[model samples]
Target: MNRNALIAAMIMALLGGFLLFAYLKKFEEEASGGAPVKLLVARKHIEPGTVVTDDMLATRVVPAAYVETRAVREAEKARVVGLRLATPVQAQQTLLWTDLAITADDKRDLSSLVQPGMRAVGVRAANDDKSFALMRPGDRVDVIATFPIEGSTQRQSIVLLQNVMVLAVGLDTTAIDTSKQGGSPSSQDLLLNLSLTLPEAQLLSLAAEKGRISVALRNPDDVRITDSLADLNSNLLTDSKTRKTVQDFRKTPTGPVKLPSAAGAQ
Candidate 1:
C-alpha cells in the first residue's frame, strides 16, 4: 500500500481497538452498578458528638449508582472536617450528612461528642465558681477537688484530673448562643460536660456526689502534664505560702476533678 493509505489503515485499526475497550469497560461498569466514585468513610469507629478531624476519615471507592445523596462525596469531604458527628459510625462505613451535628438536627446528647472508647461525664461545680463559665468546648483544663479528710476538720484541696478536655458547658458544647446573651446562667445548671475514660468518669461521679469539684481553666496551646504534684491538704490550706502555690497551680493542666481516695473512704 502507499504511505498515505497505510497510515489511514493503521489509524482505523487503532480507533476500532479503543472503541472496543471503551465498550467493554462500560458494560462491566453497568453490570456492577456504575463507575467507581469517591466517598467519605469512617477510618475507625467514631462516636457521636465527637468533632470530625482529618485522621478519623478515609475515602472509599463506591459504585456511583449505589451512592446516596446523604453520603458525603469526595468533592465535599472538607465540609465535614471541623464539624461534629451526630451519630456513631463504624469503621469503613459510609458517612452521611445526617450523621453530622449541624443546625437543628444536632442531637442534644453529649454521648455523640465523646471519643470512641471514652465516656462523657458531667462534673458539677459550685455556682459562684467562675472557672467553668470561662471554659468553652475543646478547651483543656485540670480538675481540682476539695473535700473533708478523715483526720482533719479543714477541707483538703488536691489536684484530681490533669489535661482534660471540656466537652460542653451545661449541655451547650459550642458556646453561649448570641440569642441567649440577655439570659443568665441558672444556679441549678452547674454541670460541665467533660470527656473522660470509664474509670475517670466513675471517679468523678463519686467525687461530685461526696465532695466539691472545680474546673481549673487551661490555655489551649499548653499541653504539659506535671509529673510531680503536691496535694493541697490540711497543712497547705492553713499555710500562708499556699496562697501563692495555689495561684501558680491554677495555671497548669486541667481535667475532671475527683477525690482519688474516694474508693477507700468510710
Candidate 2:
C-alpha cells in the first residue's frame, strides 16, 4: 500500500475506536440508571394536612430513570416545607407535586375571605383526633369548652359555638384525607382555621386559654340550632363502672396516661 493510504487507514482505525469507546460508556450509564438526581423525600411518615417543615424533609440522589415524573426535587424543597400535604407519604417515600394540599397553590390573601362582621382564627387540632385534621373548608363544627367551673369540684363541658364554618383544616381547606397516608400522626400540629363572629372569637379565646377546647363535627345540611342544651359534668356518667373509675381518679387526680398514638409511628 502507498504511504499516504497506510496513514489514512491508521487514522480511521483510531477514530472508530474512540467512537466505539464513547458509545459503550453511554450505554453503561443508561443501564445503571442514568445520572443521579437530587430528589426530596419524607424523612419520616407524613400525615395528610400536616404542614411540612425542613426537618421532616430529606434529599437523596437516585437514578434518574427510577424517579417519578411528578416527584419533588431538591430545588422545590423551600416551597414544600411550609405547605400542607393533601395525601400522606411514607418514610423515605418520594414527594410528588400531586401530594401537595389544595392550599399549597393558594396565594390569595385569607383576609379577603373574611367578611366585615367575621374573624378568622387558627386552632391546634389534637394529634389524637384524626377527625379535626380531616375536616374540610366550609364544614360546620360545634366548639365545646371543657374546663373547671367556678365553685364546682368537676369540670363542665359546654358548647361554646354551634354551626360555625371551618375555614381551613391544617390550612388545607379540604375535609378529605388519603387512606394511604394513615399512620402515626406527625409531630407538627394540625392547624385548623375557623370563621367566627367577633363575639364568638372572644369567647373562644377566653375558653381556649381557660381550658381545653374540642370541636364536634356537624352535618352540613343540618343547621337546626338546639336550645336549652345542658352542660355535661360528672353527674352525667350513668355507667357505674365508669363513674367509679372517674371518681377514684378525681379523688387523687393523676392526669390520663400518655400512650402511643393509634397510628403507630414507623
Candidate 3:
C-alpha cells in the first residue's frame, strides 16, 4: 500500500474510536443519574366519581432526564380515575399538557325519610305571623293531635308522628320570589308535606276527626333511631306530669259530708 493511504486509514480509525468512546460515556451518565420515577398517590383508596386534588401527587421517584420543575408542575394538575387505592403508580398518571382541576359538590339532604310504599300525608301551617316566616323544608318536627276520645271527659293531646320531615313550608318547597310573582302572596298561609306510616296515618286521621291537629317543632339533634312503639309510649308517659297531677287531685276531694246533719237538724 502507498504510505499516504496507510497514514490516512490510521487517522480515520482514531477519529471513529474517539466518537464511540464519547457516546458510551454520555449513555453511562444518563443511566447512573437516579431511580426511575414512581407515581405518588393521594389516598390509599378512593371511590368512583371522586375528584383528584393536588394532595394526590406522587413526587419521590421520576425518570432522571424527565425530572424538571416544569414537568412536576404539569404533573400536579393531572387527574386519573382508574387509580385503585394502594396500587403502585408511575409517571403515566401525571398530566403533561392540560390545565384543569377535578372537583364537585356532593351535598345531600339527610332528613327525608319518604320511601316507596310508605303512606304519607301533606300538612301545612304557619311559622310566624306571616306564612312565609315559618318552617323550611328538611326541618324535623313532632306532630301533635288534640282530640276528645269517646266517653272521655276531657280532651287529650297525643303525638301522632315523631321526627317527621317538613318537606315544604309554603306553596313552594324551595322559595317564592314575590318580586317575580308581580305581587306579594298572603303571608299567613303556609303548607307542609310530611311522611307517615300506615298506623301513623290511621291515628292522625282518627285524631283529626275529633279535634284540631298541630305540629310541634322538635330539636334538630333529635333523631329517629328506633321504631319501637313501647319505647315511644314510655317516653311520652315520662314527659307527661299531668297524668300524675290528675290522679292526685282525684284521690283528694273538696266537699262537706251531711250524714250527721240529717239526724240532728230540725
Q: Rate the local accuracy (lDDT) of all candidates.
A: 0.73, 0.73, 0.49
Q: What is the lDDT of residue 188 in candidate 2?
A: 36
How would you encode candidate 2's per-residue C-alpha lDDT over 1-266 as one tens digit per residue?
69999999999999999999999999988998887789998999999889999999999998876664446789878767888887899999988665777443553345644545678888786557766655666677889999997897888889898877776555454434532577754533266778888888899999989888898887766665666665778655776875676456534423233556688677
Q: Could you tell which candidate, 1 or 3, scores higher by lDDT?
A: 1
- Ranking 1 against 2 by TM-score, winner: 1
Q: What is the lDDT of residue 82 in candidate 1?
A: 90
lDDT of 1 by residue, 124-222 (tens): 767676455555566788887878987668777777888787777775655333234555565434667777889988887777776888877776667
Residue pairs whose backbone atoms clash in candidate 3: 37-61, 37-62, 38-61, 40-58, 123-192, 124-191, 124-192, 131-187
Q: Ten residues in a row with the worst lDDT in model 1? A: 173-182
Clashing pairs in 2: 135-175, 136-174, 136-175
For model 1, what is the C-alpha lDDT against the true structure? 0.73
State the weakest 10-residue window (summed lDDT) of model 2.
Answer: 249-258
Best-performing candidate as measured by TM-score: 1
lDDT of 3 at 235: 28
Summed backbone clashes in each candidate are: 12, 3, 8
